[model samples]
Target: MKTNYQREITKHIETNQLSYLFIMILFIVGLIFGAMIVVSMHFTQKQDLLFYLNQYFSRIDQQEILNHFDLFKSALFSHLQYLIIFLLLGLSIIGLPIIWVTIFIKGTFIGFSVGFFVYQYGFSGLLFISAAILPQNLIVIPVYLFAATIAMIFSGQLLKKLSGRRFIRFTVEPVSQYLIVFVVLFGFCLLAALIEGYLIGYYLPLVRQLIN
Candidate 1:
């Protein structure tokens, strides 16, 4: 009887595996699509950053702008932190659409930033983004996707519970898993930021100068 029960449980898990896999795949696909949208927005908002920079240069001294780079980077880091936290919390409360919108917004920002670079330097702008943006995104996107997947799964389980599914054991594991993933995600984000600040910020400018 025990062996039969074990076999049945294993079979159930196996049957449901595809659904979980599909959710994960959707998360990844959503991320890539979000990135592409952001890249597009970058192109659309091409002159925005340069215009702001130009105005700053006109008003402020050149040395001031250079000196403020660290401040600017710090502000960006803070914003990213807030955005991550907000999105994670929001995902837990709201439905998947809310999470999707959050991701889309991120993608739009990436697109706008990339577009701005392209506007400033043409193809060379791509290199700037590759150095600065790619490194952090490599860490961040997967984390977001995983969080989104977990949230969606949790929501689905909640729905199942609501729909009179007595056999389903809806518990705290999903939330706990989400918290663990969130911590890991933030750690990766911190590492990515460090790489961006140290490696990309320090070396990429030199590379650009060399290429130019």
Candidate 2:
């Protein structure tokens, strides 16, 4: 406990954790603000968001669980769309704004979806939300933030490199690290997809039954 090296390592780890937390908070503020924007829009704008939500939820409620592989493939396809965006965010320093924009979309969609479900179904919608959204987002949202944070760090490094600053490193190491994180994050996404495709199918009908 008294060793200087151990203390230094611990200190560095704690500092890094704090820095990540700060950045995550900033990202969350942006996300929540985006969500609030959807929630706060005037009647016409809300009508547009609501129009889509109506179609989406009606389709969701009417969906029949099909073949396992087909369902998994479908779920995987949806997750992959977001995965591709995160992959791009990690690869391109210029895509930080893209990440921010995607985060906004994510937040806005979740907010609008939740608001709509609650409005349409009242208390019963919470069960639908729990069944459909909670399981995957539990993993996916962290991965989103984690990927965003890594991209933010790399973007800063790229800026330093552009300015010809010394003691700054860019390129391969960061990219390799990003790829590693991407692989791990995608693995989690795969798990979420599996849960969404197969497991949730079983549970969602049961949830609807309880609602009835």
The TM-score between candidate 1 and the true structure equals 0.61
Q: State the lDDT at 107 in candidate 2.
A: 61
Q: What's the true lDDT of residue 161 in model 1?
A: 65
lDDT string for model 1 (92-200, tens) is 5346566555555555566566655665567777876776578767776666655555555555555556677467665787667656666766676667666665666
Summarize candidate 2's per-residue lDDT along 1-212 as a digit string, tens digits.
46996896578557568546855666566656655665567878767866885665455567744355677788778777876776776566587677667765676567666665665566787777777778877887787777666666666556657778465654587678667777877788889878877887656656665344
In angstroms, what RMSD does candidate 2 have relative to the true structure? 4.4
Off by over 4 Å in 1: 1-49, 55-93, 165-170, 204-212
Model-by-model lDDT, in order?
0.58, 0.68
Candidate 2 segments whose C-alpha is farther than 4 A from its true place: 1-19, 26-65, 165-171, 210-212
Quality of model 2 by C-alpha lDDT: 0.68
Question: Residue 81, candidate 1: how far off, in angstroms?
Answer: 3.7
